[model samples]
Target: MAFSELNLSTELVNAIPNSFASETQIQSLAIPAIVTQRDVLALAQTGSGKTLAYGLGIIERVHATGLQQALVLVPTRELAKQVVDALQPIAAELGHSITVICGGEDVEQQVQRLGDCPEIIVATPGRLLDMIRKQLIDTKRIDMLVLDEVDRLLDMGFWPDVQCIINDLVNRQQTLMFSATLPETLQAKVTKFLNNPLKVTANKINSVVEHIEEKLYLVNKGSKTNVLIKQISEQKWPQVLVFIGARDNADALCKKLNKAGIECEALHGNKDQAQREQVLLAFKQGKVKVLIATDVLARGIHVDALPVVINYELPSDPSVYVHRVGRTARAGKAGLALSLVCHGETAHLEAIRQLTKRALELNQLQEFPVTDKPSTGENKRPKRDKQANRRTNQKTRASQFKGKK
Candidate 1:
């Protein structure tokens, strides 16, 4: 359906770009209720137009010159910036200022920005909570609150801070919780914050879109880098996002790729906000061909026409598989999600398979095929071969006839 058909204000509808002729499923389901001040619980996969779904609602309810503000709590700094980027232009049109608050930046600078009294605040929960404690920002004026990426909020260790912020924002009239999958832990606790929310399930919680082509490759743990290098070289994909398990690995993989003659960059929590923003900008502008990032940084990133997402290391949670792959195949574009599964990592892949019904079966790379004891990360000789080699060594030593005890 068209944006104009969502029962939004005519002024708001006219502000949207005309190129957006029809709404995504999430937008179609969410915009109407959000505009009418209904608490919405949206369960949709990544890249399902969720940012705009709540953003438009935030815009529709917010008066540019009014004291009523909106607060959006997200799990990562990348997502907070993504939300602001998506809404800032349109908000500027209506004189609604969208402010972003996250760690790794100058607290004084953020304080100055907050002093401008932005009508909308998109922020990571931790930073937002810190500001709340310090009294640098006022949450009491917030009338609408959005909890994005609810499942991972607890994983991020922001549960208490989120709860505290939610309580401090005592004046919230509408609440929206959006996630690809909402775990039971969050479901029960979040109920108290919502007032009879309108639950909307756009898709099965863990299901992936039909457009993403999922591929799994089984390889020895040590051979993952070599195999990834070979794939990138052979395929020559325009852009690739590799999800590594840890910050150190993300850096090591990026270095390995660059040493192999492919331009790459690494992003993780250790990087300050300026550095994170720079790396993300370079990758988005095609200045960097390969971006190796940890789960938190890659989550909720907005990349257009991204053709591939490689799981260098599977995330700990099975549900995260959907978020990682969802980075590709966005906006109905055909994309590929290649998962590099090493021995002992099949359990993670198994969980992903169970979570989603996508046709994913493990295949071995020709050179990096499954080897004996690979699960232990060592290739050991067979027992018979060792015995034969020991006998040959004994014979050779006796022929030498020189023994030193």
Candidate 2:
């Protein structure tokens, strides 16, 4: 569908490059409703163009009114960056400006940006509240408030920060919220913060992308790393993302993979903005072959034609599992999501199975040894062969005797 079909201003529509031609279901439906000045609650899978759906609404409204009147609260610094990057150009085309306020940056710079009176602010909840507390920004002028990834914001325990920001701006505004899943807590927040809202669900809550070819590898824990390496070596995937459960694991796994002659990078919570951006930018540009990350960096990331997503470690939340796989199969392209399941994680794998409601097809490893456990009577660390040991001892004795004589 064309951007002009949404009835946005011609300038706004033209500013959007041809890249956004194939609008996702969420955007196709929600964009028009949002542009009509309706408060929206959009339910769609990650990578479904929800960001641009609401971003266009925020930009169009602010442009028409010619005021600094929009605020978007996101869950992570990376997501905030993605939202701002997607919307800033369109806003610029309409002669509007956007200020990004998130953690891991110089606060003084944000303050300076606020002083310039940007037309829109794309921010993370914590840093937004921090700025508000310091009197660095004014909430009174905000006529449109958005909570992107509301479920994740609640998961991160940003309720107090979100509430504080909303209460401060309660006088009057339109509220738009988007999430992969809407739990009761977020529903309650909607009740308190939003007036009568229009709801739109572009996909079922438990839906998995059918375009992704899902595979599972049931390998023993000891050789899982080798199995992953073998899989990557066998295929010349242009860009691969591996999801580990912890930040330290992500770093260590990247090091191990790179040591095996596979160029890779790690992304997690600890990496500062510059490092994260560098790795992500390089990976997107195909300069890096693999990216190791935790679930924190997985959501709302847009990469073009990334064919492979490996779940090195599964996330506890099923919703996160959906998000991880959704990173691939994006923009109407076919992709692959492969999971490696060891013996100990059977129960966790079962949960994922129940969540997706589809039996995963297992793929056997390629001639790699599986170290399940020692045989019943066999020693884990057996003694060396007796003949070889005896020969070594005899040679040592002869040499000693010769020296003594």
Candidate 3:
């Protein structure tokens, strides 16, 4: 189905770019439900045009009366900005405006912007709740509430704040929740938030995209950095996103890569908004070849046609492995995801295999052989000193004899 057949206004349909020929599965299913004012829980892939699915509905329904009729709560400031950018054109065509409320921006300035009473507000939960507590923005009159990337928001521990904000929206008429995966915990929250909602899924949850070629390289932890540098030099991908388990690892790996003559940058929660934006812009503009980032900061990253994603360190949770690799092979583009697995991380690799339901074969790099032994699980408990045990037994016998005497 096309945007023109989705019951959208002529202006909104014209506002949609001509490049988007037909509606994606998520968009085709979601637009009709949202236009009819029904709650929706959409489970779609990372790059399946989810932003447009809801953005079109929002523009079609919201009035330009400047009363903040719609609220879109994303997981990060970058995503908030992306959502606003996606909606701005259509919103402008319809005479409605969107204001972004998120962290890492001046709250007072946000307050000043709130005075304009934009018809739509795209925000992160923390700053939006802060504004709500400060009485700067009222949510009671919000007609539609959108929780984009709901799983990520919950993963980031925004449930309490999300619930608090939802409580204030006593008059909300519609709720739309979108996520890549719907865990049981998220399902419970969805039950509470959505009322008789339509569940729309575009692809298989927790599975990698079909276009992505996944490979696992087994190397020792000591040689992970060396192996990574070797792989990058060998592959010579124009743009690669490397995911590290920690922020310090991201910084350390970035430095090592740069020292190896690779133009790289580090992105994490520690970097300020401007620095983060600069790094992303540089990577996007091809000024930087590799971007090393932790999962938290990488959640909001949306790079077009990014060819490679390397897991420098595996996440403890297998599902996160899916999310990390999902960064590439987006929008039906062919991509590659390479995971550097160490002997100690076999368990992690196993978990990922189970979650993704893929028989992942371990490919050993001839230059980077694995010398480390796999964990036997027996060494988890410290070995007792046999000599010390013998001495203790003798001492106990002697003490018992003395007591008898």
Candidate 4:
């Protein structure tokens, strides 16, 4: 079905950007349910056009009337800004406007923008909760609550704030949830917040799109940078997004990549919102060839036709691996996810394989051989420090007990 057949307003349909094709799987299935004012829980991949699934619904129910009718809760400041940027143009065509509320920006400025009474408010939980405490926004006027990337919100430990916001919105009438991958444990908990929501899974949950090619390389921990630089130079990829494990690592790796003649920038929590936006714009616009980012960018930032995502360091939770590599192979385009695994890193690689449910092929770059042997999992006894050895054994046993639940 086309956008016109989704039952959206003719004006709204006509206003959709020419760049956006008529329909994506998520939009086709979730838009109709939302337009009818029914609560919906939608599951779709990161690059599968999930935003428009609920964006159109919010646009249909609101106009330039100026009372905030839709409230969208997201996981990060980047995502909050991204949601507004995606919907504002289409919304304005129908006489409605959208504003973003997030931390790392001037709260007074945000309050001033809210005074305009946009039809939709896109916000992160912490800042939104702060606004409520100051009585900046009238929750009574919001009727639709959208938990965008709901699973990531839970991953980031926002359930308490989310619940508080829901309770504060005494008059909220409908709820819409959308996520790429949700844990079964969390699914049961979040469902109670909705009213018999129509659950729509547009794609396999916790899985990558079919077109993505997964590659694994086992290397010495100290040789990862050499291998990464070699691969990028060999492939001549126009752009690549690299996920690291920490904010400091992102900055450090970015500097080294630039030193090696690759135009690179880092995105992480340490950067203010303005800086993050500038870095993302550069990466998307082709000004930056490689972007070193932390997991914060895994969920909601969209880069059109990006062809590669590299895991310089795998995430702590295997499920997050889904969102990290999702940066590429978006919008039906073929992409690549290259992972560099060192000796001790095999545990993380194994976790990713388990979550993806694929026997991902492991490779050795004949050029950069891995000389470090993989861990044997055996605890070697220190003959000189008998007491210390006993202490280590006790700690290991306790850890094993904890792992057994």
The global C-alpha lDDT for each of the candidates, from Candidate 1 onward, is 0.85, 0.82, 0.84, 0.88
Error of 1 at 192 (Å): 2.4
Cα RMSD, each candidate: 6.5, 8.6, 4.4, 6.8
Error of 4 at 34 (Å): 0.4
lDDT of candidate 4 over 1-405, digit per residue (tens): 789998877888899999887789999999888878889999988889898888988887774223358999999988888888899989887778788898998999999988888889999999999899889988898988999999888878898999999999998888999999987898998999999899999988888888889898888889999888888988999999999999998999988888899888999989887898899999989999999999989987889889999999878788888888888998889999999888787787788778778888779889898799878998777457888677667785555545434
TM-score of each: 0.90, 0.88, 0.92, 0.92
Candidate 3, poorest ten consecutive residues by summed lDDT: 396-405
What TM-score does prediction 1 earn? 0.90
Q: What are the per-residue Cα lDDT tens digits for candidate 1 across 275-317?
A: 9999999989998889998886556888888999999888778
The residue pairs in collision within model 1 are none
291 in model 2: Cα distance from truth in Å? 0.9
Which candidate has the top score in lDDT?
Answer: 4
**Who is ahead in TM-score, 2 or 4?**
4
Residue 381 lDDT in model 1?
Answer: 66
Clashing residue pairs in candidate 3 are none
Task: Write one digit per residue (lDDT tens) for candidate 2, span 1-405.
Answer: 777887678888888868877667888888888777788888887667888889888887776645357898999888898888888888888788998999999999999998888888889988989888888888887878899988888887998889889888854468899987775555776756666788889987656777888988878877878888888988978889999999998888888898898888999889888998888889889998899999877678888898999999777777788889989988778999999877666667777787778788666665864567523555669788999687667785555545434
Q: Estimate candidate 4's alpha-carbon lDDT, on a 0 to 1 scale.
A: 0.88
| Candidate 3 local Cα displacement, residue 57, angstroms | 1.1
Decreasing lDDT order of the candidates: 4, 1, 3, 2
User: What is candidate 1's local distance difference test score?
Assistant: 0.85
Task: Count clashing residue pairs per candidate.
Answer: 0, 0, 0, 0
